[model samples]
Each structure stands twice: as structure tokens, then as C-alpha cells.
Target: MGIKSFLASRKNQNKITTHMPLKVSDYMSTKLITFKTDDKIETVIDSLIKYRISGGPVVNSKHELIGIISEGDCIKQLSDSRYHNLPMTNNTVEACMIKNVETIDGNMNIFDAANKFLESKRRRFPIVENGKLVGQISQKDILKAALALKGHDWK
Candidate 1:
């Protein structure tokens, strides 16, 4: 049988679930470094560097996620400032954040989340529950889960 057909034939079998599929909550990082919409880009940059992260979720006054800010976003702001011959210090995260963000629920399967990572340009996904930020999932998290599934110690 062809590889595709063989895999397709086994799709309905429970062979893959020898162990339960990893859930987002199982692998997502709960200790997140988040930012506020009105926070200064400079401060956000410093925090991102301090936290050793590429980006973070941006929240509102009520701690509801409103956008996402990343090193790429920060770079865009700097590029624009240089282009316009203006100081980069005056900008806020809100000015450069990606307002329409894609979020995942904590209960989502790691396979589904992996598909999202493969299909999009985002390096991470913000985990939300009841419209509140709960955790963050990244490619690294998925890799860890995959390694664990294969009976390998990722840590």
C-alpha cells in the first residue's frame, strides 16, 4: 500500500493515542512576560530582552488581551522612525502591535496547534480561557511535547 493510503487507513484506529495527545496546558508556558497596550516601546524592548523572549501579548487595563507585540514589530517602529527622521522613544506598543491576534484555548490538542504553527507566520500563540490570557504556546513548546511523545526527554 502507498504511504498515504496506509496512513489514511489507520486514521480511524487509536494507535496514535497510546498515550493521550498533549494538550496546550500541558506544554504551554504559564509564566508569561506580557505587555500593556500603552506601554512605551523602549520599555517593552527592555522587558523582552530581560525576559529573553522574542515578543509578548499586549493587554488592556482589565488585563484582556488586545494585541501582540514582537521584536519584529519593534523593528518596524524603529525603521519608520528612521525613515521619518523622528525619535523612536515616543512610540507606544499600541502603535505597532498586531491588533488582530489568533489565540488558542488551553484544552486544544498539540497536533492542532502544530498545524497552526505550520500554516501561519506567528512563532507563538497566546492561550486564552474565558477571554483572559492564561498562557503562551510556542514552537519550542510543541517540539518538547513531540519529543516527550516519542519517549524522549526534552529537558
Candidate 2:
């Protein structure tokens, strides 16, 4: 082989495969199931069961995320007498939702998102874009992404 051709082939063989940087937007579930602040606990519970989700984002009339509610929060009500009777129906979602919620930006790196979920022990997180609810990310989502990258499909 000619020297130039040999050098060209060697250069091609030395090329390295680079992984594209992962963005939260790329991995986050866009089919966001959300609840409103004024929604009833029973309504939230029904949606949770219907969607088979552990938690979801709470939004206002403007579609801005106000807080979040999870199955854990609903379970807490089962033990409280105030939430046991018919009068409890008057309570709103805002009363039961966790206002101090952890959020992740859609532009953040997936690794950073995984680290945050691990450090905070949060299972579900709302994805925000310009302070508005765009989607959601969960531990399951991250795990699915990781598995896909590893060439394994999660069962």
C-alpha cells in the first residue's frame, strides 16, 4: 500500500466514539400527568391509580408548578382522623401537597439529575422550563436511560 493510503487507514482506525451529552429534555417523559392545587385528595388518588404513577406535579391556572404530591402523602392521610370523615372532603390538594419541592431544569445533564435524585432520595421530579411545568423525571426514568445506554432493556 502507498504511504499516504496507509496513514489514512491508520487514522480512521484510531477514531474514538464519543457519547452525546444527555439532556434532561432528551430523557424526561413528555406525557406529563399533572394535578391542580385546588384538586381534591380523592381526585389525586384516582389519577395516581389511573396512571399507575407514584407522584405527579401540581400546577396552577397558569400551568406553573406550585408543588408536588405522592402516594406517600396520600398514605399519611389514611392515618389522620381529620382526613377520615366526610368533612375531610373539603380539604384541597394544596393542603396535602409538598410545597418545598425539588425541581430539575430541562437543560441539566442527566448525570447531575441522577446525582440529585440519589442525594435527595426523591423518586419523582418535575421538569421545569422557564418556571413552567413541561414534563417529569423519575428514578425509573433515569434507570431506564441508564439501561438503554448499557444496551439492556428494563423489565
Candidate 3:
């Protein structure tokens, strides 16, 4: 093959391999443990500890994501004696949650998703579609994907 032809073929092959599209569904974890808006702060804290997760989507009665809660929210509650001593009946997830939830669809690229996570200061992100909670993506998940892409297993 001529040198010019070989160079052009190699460049095209590089472009094809390097620009391979990635979808969020490829990395998002579908086994999601979500919270209800009416759930108590104690319950949310319990779930976070039990699952060893930082945070997740908060859904309403119809399973539509309306907010998000995190360990940070619980910590914030502890700062007030009223919240700390209040009964579960007096406290609700919505009160302490981040109502302006930021979500990503399953079709988003992993890099773009990572950028969103960084921009949002969120460790966990709820995957959604048409206003319904579908799955979750976490910083750990993104790091795992990066490690795997580099042919290394995350320890």
C-alpha cells in the first residue's frame, strides 16, 4: 500500500475507535434503592447506612422523582435540636431534601455524566426518564468505569 493510503486508513481507524459512543445505561446501576418523599429522616439515614450509599432519588407516591436526599441533608438536620428530637411524624424527607434535583438520562455519555456530577457537587445521581426514577449513577461507578477502561480493576 502507498504511504499516503496507509496513513489515511490508520487515521480513520483511530477516529472510529477513539470516538466510540458511550451511553449512561452502559454504566448506571439499575438495582436502585430509592426513598419516598414522606419517609422520615431516620429512615433515610438508616437506608444510607444499610446500603452503604451516599444518596439517591426521592420519589413520590406515583414513583416519580421529586427530590433527592443525601447524608449531608441528615447531617444538616442534626444541627437543629428541633429536628433532632422531633418525632418521625413531625419530619419529612422533603423538608431536608434537595428539591431541585439534577438528573441524567440513560443515553448520556459517561464523560458527560461525570462532568455533571462534578458540576453539581453530587456524589450520587438518580437516573431518570420522563420524570420517573429508573436507575442510579455514583462517583464510585464512574471511577470504576474509568479504571476498567484503563484495563485496571479498582481496588
Query: Judged by lDDT, which candidate is best?
Result: 1
Give per-model TM-scores: 0.81, 0.81, 0.77
**What local lDDT does model 1 show for residue 56?**
95
The residue pairs that clash in candidate 2, if any, are none
TM-score of decoy 2: 0.81
Candidate 2 regions exceeding 4 Å error are: 1-9, 12-21, 82-86, 152-155
Residue pairs with backbone atoms closer than 3 Å in model 1 (clashes)? none
**Candidate achieving higher lDDT, 2 or 3:** 2
Q: Residues 1-155, candidate 2, lDDT per residue (tens digit)?
A: 64578878899999887765478778899888888888888888999999999988888988898999889887776547365554565456788889988788888888889999989998988888787889898888888778766763235
Cα lDDT, all candidates: 0.87, 0.82, 0.80
User: Which is the better candidate, 1 or 3, if ranked by TM-score?
Assistant: 1
RMSD versus native structure for model 2: 4.3
Tens digits of per-residue lDDT, candidate 3, 28-79, equal 8988878887788889889999998887788887789888888988877765
Residue-wise C-alpha lDDT for candidate 1, range 17-123, written one tens digit per residue: 35555798999998888898779999988998898999999987777889999999999998999998988766898889999999988898999999989999679
Q: Cα miss at 73, model 3 (Å)? A: 0.7
Q: Least accurate stretch of 10 residues (summed lDDT) in model 2?
A: 81-90
- When summed lDDT is taken over every stretch of 10 residues in candidate 1, the lowest stretch is 12-21
* Cα lDDT, model 1, residue 25: 92
